[model samples]
Structures are given as C-alpha cells and as structure tokens.
Target: MECLLGLLKVKVVRGVNLAICDPLTHSSDPYVVLRLGQQKVKSSIKYHTINPEWNEELTLSITNMMHPVKIELFDHDTFTKDDSMGDAEFCILDFVEIAKRDLSDVPDGTVMKTIHPEKANCFATESHITWKDGKISQDIVLKLRNTETGELVLHLHWVNIPGVAR
Candidate 1:
C-alpha cells in the first residue's frame, strides 16, 4: 500500500522565526510534516476537534542548506494509504548567525526571566531563543539588511522550548 502526503514550502531566516498553520476540519487528528532538505519532521499534535488549528512556530537554526525546506500538513487518518487531504506550502526563511547564548553556558550577570500568560486554562510563554548581534540600545533602533532582498527581517521573539528537559 502506498501513501500520499501533502506538500508545503518552508522558508527560514537565519535568526528570524516563522509560524505555520495546519487546518484540517474533517478528521479527528490533524498533523503536519516538515521537510528540511533531506530531513523530515513530523508533528506531535493529534486528537483535534473539527476544523482543528495548529499555529506552530519554528526557528531557523541550521544554515547549511541551499534549497527551500518544505512543510506539508495533513489529516492523520488521510495521511496514509492514499487518504491524504492536501498539503500547504511555505518558503523556508533564511537565517544568519549572529550569536549564541546557551543558558547553562552563559558567562555571568545575564538575567533571564520567564513570563507566561494564562489563556484557555493553559500557560503560554516564549520558550525559543536565537541570539543575534543586533540589539536596541539607548533607545535606538537596530536592524539587519537581508542580503537577498535588502529587507530587514528581525528575528522578533523566541517562544518555544528547544528540547525535552532531562
């Protein structure tokens, strides 16, 4: 038996973050497939209600690929054995390396606090961070020019944990 999966385009900016939505209405489980070059990432979001929504944000960490990463969303029941509904496309953003700050590897005197807002009986907080060289200092705005389009895309904010805690 063969299975057909949806297709989506993923764009990543070296330091910028992007959000992708997976909308599937007629299934009990709606999940998405993220393809980064030869690497494929599957979602863990399952058991969704009708018209389930998944607004997932991913940060650009790897800068070794030249092709656009692909992201495909599908209904779990229809994702296998020729039951796929469809796919969504997003251009994987490009990223630039500026800086890296690991919590356990930080130097000293760097304060980091977490702020989580309660919504729908759930706690939400920013958990992802991609350090860059630009920072707003002395009430001055800082920006980085995109080499491709001469556009300045800030890696706005980080809001997602990196991996499972040991």
Candidate 2:
C-alpha cells in the first residue's frame, strides 16, 4: 500500500480561445486529462467550442511532492483517436510548502507567492498562491506549448492527509 501523503484537488475551471482542431466544423470537442505519475483523471468532453468551460474537479493522489502534474487537452473524436490540442505541466511544491505552514495569522486572500511566466514554465500570465477560505491554493493561466492560440485556467487546492506528516 502506498503511504498516505496528500490529495491534490485540481479544479479545471475553463479553456480560453483553444485551437480549432476540427477543420470541417471549425471547432473542436475538447477534454482535459491530468496526470500525476501513474494516475490519470479526465474531464467530460465539451463539444463545438473554442472556449469551453469545464468546471471539473479532478483529484490526484500525492506520494512524491516533487512529481510534476501534467495537463493535456485533446479533441475528442468519435471514429478516430483523440487529437492533441496541447500540453502543459506544473509543480505543486510551493503550494504544498505553504500548506505545511502555520498560517493562523495569515489573512484571507493573502498572496503567499507570485509566479511569472518564464521560458521554463507554462504560465500564460502571472500566477498567485493565495491563502483563501483557510486553505492554500493557486490560480494559473497556462499557455499551451506546441500549439497556437490556447490557454488553460485551473485552480490547485492542497488537501492534507491525517495521521501522516510530510
């Protein structure tokens, strides 16, 4: 059995101006799949839109804090394999670090960390790890790599496991 570490509640809020992978209809049926190690969680497919609001919450188990989370957007096809829209990756180390803090005095909506878009990262714009509603979380707008004209917005919530100290 795997040692209980933590749970990452990933809220896949929406996609912004995604690529039109389908040529005939000029739109794409897109779905998001998030991978952490050997675990994969997928969201429902939203059809015929460049901008789709998923509002999906995918939970991923955390055994290694250093593991990178991978996000991929695919165009769901009925008769063929799903076409890849693009992919991006992120790390939860900073968020996890803040979650391990004693933030009794930290104000709600306080920004703990601000991450900017660099060549080494997938952030489309800036991101903030904030303390909100008595939890550590972050909102990010990731610029998709290997594709033109697409961005993904998501929220990362850190859930601690009881009886296990990390």
Candidate 2, residues 1-166: lDDT per residue as tens digits? 7675788899999999999999999999999999988999999999999899989899998887788899999999999999999999998878777888879899889999999989988998899999999888999999998788899999889898887785
Task: Count clashing residue pairs per candidate.
Answer: 25, 0
lDDT of 1 by residue, 1-166 (tens): 2221212222222211112122343234545465655567665545544233344444433333344544444445544442233332222222211122234554343323322333321112232223323321011011212211111111233222245121
Supply the global lDDT for candidate 1.
0.31
The best candidate in terms of TM-score: 2
Q: Which stretches of candidate 1 lie over 4 Å from their true place?
A: 1-28, 48-50, 55-61, 78-82, 93-166
Q: Which whole-number lDDT from 0 to 100 does residue 37 have in model 2?
A: 89
lDDT on C-alpha atoms for all candidate structures: 0.31, 0.90
